[model samples]
Target chain A: DVKVTQSSRYLVKRTGEKVFLECVQDMDHENMFWYRQDPGLGLRLIYFSYDVKMKEKGDIPEGYSVSREKKERFSLILESASTNQTSMYLCASTTAGANTGELFFGEGSRLTVL
Target chain B: GESVGLHLPTLSVQEGDNSIINCAYSNSASDYFIWYKQESGKGPQFIIDIRSNMDKRQGQRVTVLLNKTVKHLSLQIAATQPGDSAVYFCAETGSGNTGKLIFGQGTTLQVKP
Candidate 1:
């Protein structure tokens, strides 16, 4: 079974604080993604990386950035957290050239910004 | 703008009965579609998927139907149980091999005994 592990399951941060969410997948999947899940909005992609040091903006990328320093590790960064940024963050990955549209997701990290 | 949407925000059904969830997509180029189930406090899990070349597909107790003419998609769950209660989301792959998926607002399924 493939496992995508998130560094934090729950986090609380004040406005203007920097936040970092880390994810690592055991499988050697080449693609990784960061998404924020909210009520009524479902899951909105923040950023995605197809290779190390390569990143692309998704539908909602205004308040987020991502880093893929290593193949298995992908990180999401919030330069300055805000109340509106409070939501559940999910990390997902799939094998390279996989067109099946199946993504293995992590358990998700719930972040609360005060 | 191209997007995927659900017909209902929630669906309630009695246990042992069949449940159906509907979805619509605006992009005609989308060829692959998927249905996911998200339990409370967990990430979405892949339930079933259908390709444009095929109109229907089944897995275990779940069946996915695609109607390209109407651009509609539906998931049917047989013998619904309490454990099947969760938020269901429909997603379509983006234009290319980008592996990006556009998801619809999920529909929450409630099972009654």
Candidate 2:
């Protein structure tokens, strides 16, 4: 089975602190994505990478950035955490050119900024 | 801007009864749609998917129906069980090769025994 592993299941950080959320997928998929989920806003894409060292901003990428330094590793960065940034972050991946809309996702990391 | 939205925020059904969750999309160019189930504290799992070429598709106990005329989609679950209680989200493929998906706010399904 394909597994997407998130480094942190839960994290609490103070305001203005820099935070890193790491994700590693064992399937060697060509595409990786970062999304944030909130109560009424659903899952909004923060950023996505189709290749190593390449990234694209999504609809809600204002407060986030991403890095794909390796084929299997994708990281989400919060330069300065704030209370409004508190939410569940999800990592997902899929095979290249597979536009079938099926995404394998990690368990998700719940981040709380105080 | 393209967006996907749900008609209801929550749906309640009795066990053994059928449950239907509805979604609407504004992107007419979207050819692929998917339904996902997310339990408490877990990531969204793919339940079923339907392509624009087809209006209806079925899986083990779930059926997805697409209405291109109204740009609407629906997921029907047969014999809804307690284990099926979760938040259901419908997504449409965004226009691009990156395979980005626009998701709905989601509908919480509550099953009563």
Q: What are the runs in model 1 whose C-alpha is more than 4 Å off?
A: none
lDDT of each: 0.94, 0.94
Provide the lDDT at B23 for model 2.
98
| Backbone clashes counted, model 1 | 0
Per-candidate TM-scores read 0.98, 0.98
**DockQ, per-model, please?**
0.77, 0.78
TM-score of 1: 0.98
Tens digits of per-residue lDDT for model 1, B1-113: 87899999999999999999999999988999999999998889999898899999999999999999999999999999999999999999957767789999999999999
> TM-score (0 to 1) of chain B, per candidate?
0.98, 0.98
RMSD of each: 0.9, 0.9
Itemize residue pairs with steric clashes in candidate 2: none
